[model samples]
Structure formats: structure tokens, C-alpha cells
Target chain A: EAGVTQFPSHSVIEKGQTVTLRCDPISGHDNLYWYRRVMGKEIKFLLHFVKESKQDESGMPNNRFLAERTGGTYSTLKVQPAELEDSGVYFCASSQVGLFRPTYGYTFGSGTRLTVV
Target chain B: QQQVKQSPQSLIVQKGGISIINCAYENTAFDYFPWYQQFPGKGPALLIAIRPDVSEKKEGRFTISFNKSAKQFSLHIMDSQPGDSATYFCAASIGGKLIFGQGTELSVKP
Candidate 1:
């Protein structure tokens, strides 16, 4: 099925540098999500993983932002000291459970365009 | 608190015209209402969805109109083209965790 897949896509980094964004879901997907968009705004939510725990991170926006889903399969978002509003565009999504299933569509990932300068 | 509220941030239909976009939500327990379609760099995609017992839900030319007591929801794009422009999001969820609406930049002009 291979859909959600993110990586370097684009990243510039500078301010206090330290960036890491990667996602590779869609293989038995257990639900993994993280979103951000801060150019003009509107695309929030920043945490959620169902296999490596962390069901929700309450939309993490602080603590230098860090996210990881190690054993549950692909996911990582780390922005240590990066600032400059931490640039934006970092989306990773996945879905596959069954509860509200409607073919469970939620497979975004063509994002990762952080340019914190 | 901005649960959702989308409107004419941008729109300019023409090619066979008929493109409407609107959204309003404040969490009525939200019953799934999705509508996403991004293009520029790509990310969103799921162009049509509706729930709330269904007030409407088409697919071909896209349509999703649900109004559970005015919680509002809409997205119509009948014959528009120009590849149907892009950027349009209106979301709401109850169990899958979604809550967006501040996008709409459809510019379908032939």
C-alpha cells in the first residue's frame, strides 16, 4: 500500500539547529499522526501514535518539540533548538484500525519543509 | 476557540462554474466531516466525506453537504476544472482526531 512516507523532502535549518523529521507509515498502520503548518497557519495537531504508545501528545508545541515512534514502526520529529518560529510544513499521517473504519483514509505524507532560519 | 470555521479565504470559479466552500463547526461532538485536497506541495487528500447521518455525499464531481442543526459543512465543485485548483480543507472528527478549517483557495478558471 505504501502511501505515507516522508523524509528530507526539504529542510534548511539554522537557528540553534537540530532537526529531524521522518515518517514511513502505511504497512499495517496502527495510526500515527503529527502535523504542523505555519506559513499562513491552519494544520495543527502534533502528536499521536498508537503502537509505540503516545496516543496523543496534546498537540505538543513546546519542550523543543520531540516525537518518536520507534518500535511501532517509522516516525520521528525532533526540533531541538530550532526557532525562527520553527519554519513549517511537517505532516505525517497514517490510519488503519477498524473502529470508525470507512476504508480508514488518512495517509498524508509529502511534507517536511522546515526552513528555520 | 476556533474549532472550525472556514469560508471564502479565496475562490474564483469559472470553468463550467459552480464551486462553493463553507464550513462551520464548534464541536457538536463532531461526527466526521472531512474534505481535504491540497496540491502545491501535496499532503492533504480525501476530497469528500460526510457523516452526521448524511445530508448529502456525492463523489464524481465532489459534494458533501451536511448540516446537523447548523453545525454546517459544505463543499461543492460541480463542473469546475483547471484541474480544480487546490487547497481546500474543512475537517472535523470525533474519534480519529481531526479539527481543521482555515483553508480554501480554490481557483478553478479555464
Candidate 2:
């Protein structure tokens, strides 16, 4: 099966500009999650989607960031008025809901590298 | 606490030796622990995992030793190879969300 796919493998934008990252999860996977890792920092969760419904979004940094998973398929994360601190690698992961899956079935995308200057 | 602490920030090991990375968490509610390996330009991928019920789990050249009482876990790479050089992250899972520790970069010299 094709793994999770993320578009715009790399992006660079000026401060206060807007940038959007896309992720297409594997078919039949019901759990989708977004994470970000700043330079020299650990990867941190941003949000989770369970079939288009947000299960948790506490990790979202602020109002400038928005995430949406439409139709329970692909997901988009938009950073409006991007700041220098927002520059990081955005990763999307998916997992199938099952009791017998291997290691909870987490598959991560290659991730989109965002740079704000 | 929600954080997972990891150290040392980086390591260098000779091939055919062992590489160890340690992590500790303060949340006892965490029931699952997993280690992820990431190469440059790639997202993290699961290397191995262990539950609180097990003190140790090994796969191939990878092993996860869990210390539930101390709320700590470590990843051991046996017969470390140059290919095993990468950034490794330790994460604790609770309610399907992972709390990750600072990553450790491992370099194995051939």
C-alpha cells in the first residue's frame, strides 16, 4: 500500500505570509494526526482527526494555525501570517483502527518542510 | 507531567558495538512506549515498542527495555551498524496521543 503522502515537500515564505501543507492518508485509515518539529526540538503533536471530526487539538499553538480534514480523506494545515517561530517540518501520520494491527499501525508521511523568513 | 526526557543529545558508537538511548517520563498514565527512527528529510518511523507489562522486548538488532517502576525506558541497538545511525525519539502514548522526548542522534562508525 502507498504510504501517507504529503505535498509541497518544501516551502519557503516571508513572515506574515500564508502557507498551506497537504497530507493524504492511506485508504481505510480512520485516524489522522498532525505533528511539527522545530529545529533541534522534539516532534510535537498538533491535532488528531477521527473521520473528519477533531478528536484532539490541544497541541495547536495558536489561532493563526488551522487544520481541517475534509470528508475524512486528506488533511490540510494552514499557517496564516506565518512567523519565524512557525518555520518547521510538518508531518502527517495515519493509523487504522484495529485490535490486531502491528504496533498500532502508525504510518508517517515524508513531511513538508516550511521555512519563514 | 506531559514531557518525556531523553539523553544524551548525541552518541557515537563503533560498528559491532551497542548503542543505548534512554528516556524517562513522569506520567504514570502512559501505558505504551515506542521508539521512532528518523533519517534526514524523512518523518519518524516506528522502530520498536513495549508495554508496561513487559520489562523487555527485542526485535532483530533492536531492543526496548522498560522500567515501569522508574517510569523510564531505553532503546538498545545490538551490533550497531552504520545504517543504524539516525535520530531516535522516545514517546509515551496515552489516549492515542504521544508525548515525545527530545531526540537523540546516533552515529555508528564503521
Candidate 3:
């Protein structure tokens, strides 16, 4: 089976522009999550999806960031009016649910490096 | 509010030596601990993990020593090789969400 996959491995855009990142989770996985790491910073959670509904979104940095999972499949994270501080790597991860704390571990994509100039 | 803290921003170990990285967590509710390894230009991958019920877990040349009482854990690489160089992160899980520590960059020189 294939691992989690992310598109546009690297994206470069101007400040105030918009960029959309896509993630395809593993097959039959109902749990997907988004995380970001600014330069010289630890990876921080952005949001989480349990199928089509959001399980948690407390980690979203601001109103400019929006995430959606359609049909309980792939997910997209959009950054609108991107700021210089938005330059970083975005990673998507997935794991199965109904386990005892997801012990099987999460499979992460290679991540998309977003550079806002 | 960083829930997890890792030590030694960077480390240099000679090949065939032992490499150790330490992490401490502040959340008592966290029951699952995992270590992630990331190569350049790649997302972090799960290296190994341990639950509070176990004090130690080992896989191949990698080992995780978990101390639930002190709320701390560490990754140990025995007979480290140059290919083992990478950035490592320690994370604690509440439910299924992970709280990651600041990463430690390890370099095993040949």
C-alpha cells in the first residue's frame, strides 16, 4: 500500500497571494491531520479531520487559513493572502481510528515546502 | 506553551558510537510517546514508540527508554552509523493528537 501523499512538493508565491496544498491519506484511514513547521521552529498542528467533519481545529493560526476534507477522502489546506511568516513546510498525516490511541502510528507525507516571498 | 521539551539542539557522534536524545513532557494525561526521524527535505517518520505501560522498547539498533514517573523519555541508537544522521523529534500524544518537542539535529560522523 502507498503512504500518505502530498502535492506540489514545493511552492513559491508572493505575499498576499493564495496557495492551496493537497493531501491524499492512506486508504481506509478516517483520521487525517495537518501540521506546519516554520523555520527553526517545532512542528505545530493546524487541524484534524475525522472523515468529513473536523475533529479539532484549534491549531489553525488565523482566519486566513482554511482546511476542508470533501467526501471523507483527500484534504486541502488553503492559505489566503499569505504573509511572509507563512513560509514553512506543511505536512499531512493519517492513521486509522477505533484503535487504542492509534498505536500503529501515523504515516506522514513528504510535505510541501511553501515559500512566501 | 510547549508541552514537550527536547535537549541539546544539536549533537555530533562518531560512527559506531552511541547516540542519545532526551525529551521531557509536562502533560500527565499523555500516555503514548513516539520518536520521529526526518531526513532533509522529507517529512518526519515514526522511528519508534512506547506507551506508559512499558519502560523500554527496542527495534533493530534503535531503542526507546520511557520513564513515566519522571515524565521523560529518550531515544538511543546503538552502533550508530553515518546514515543515522537526521533530525529527531519526541512527541507525546493526548488521544491521537501529538504534541511535538523542539527537534534535535544529530550528526553521526564517519
Best by TM-score: 2
For residues A27-116, write the lDDT of model 2, one tens digit per residue: 999999999999999999999999899999999999999999999999999999899999999999999875323455788999999999
Clashing pairs in 2: none
Error of 1 at A73 (Å): 40
Q: Is the docking of candidate 1 incorrect, acceptable, medium or high quality?
A: acceptable
- Off-target runs (Cα >4 Å) in candidate 1 are A1-14, A17-35, A38-42, A46-57, A65-80, A83-85, A89-115, B1-14, B17-30, B34-51, B55-62, B65-75, B79-86, B95-107
lDDT for model 2: 0.92
Looking at model 2 chain A, report the run of 10 residues with the lowest lDDT sum.
Answer: A96-105
Least accurate stretch of 10 residues (summed lDDT) in model 3 chain A? A96-105
* Order of candidate numbers by DockQ, starting with the best: 3, 2, 1
Per-model DockQ: 0.23, 0.67, 0.70
lDDT of 3 by residue, B1-110 (tens): 44899987899999999999999987888878889999998889999988889999999999999988888899999999999999999998876888998899999999
Query: What TM-score does candidate 2 reach?
Result: 0.97
Stretches of candidate 2 off by over 4 Å are: A98-102
Per-residue lDDT of B31 in model 3? 71
lDDT of 1 by residue, B1-110 (tens): 43898998899989988999999987688778888899998899887788888899998998888879988879999989999899898988767878888898999878
Report how closely model 3 matches the true complex, as a DockQ value.
Answer: 0.70
Better of 1 and 2 by lDDT: 2
TM-score of each: 0.34, 0.97, 0.97
Shift in Å, residue A75, candidate 1: 29
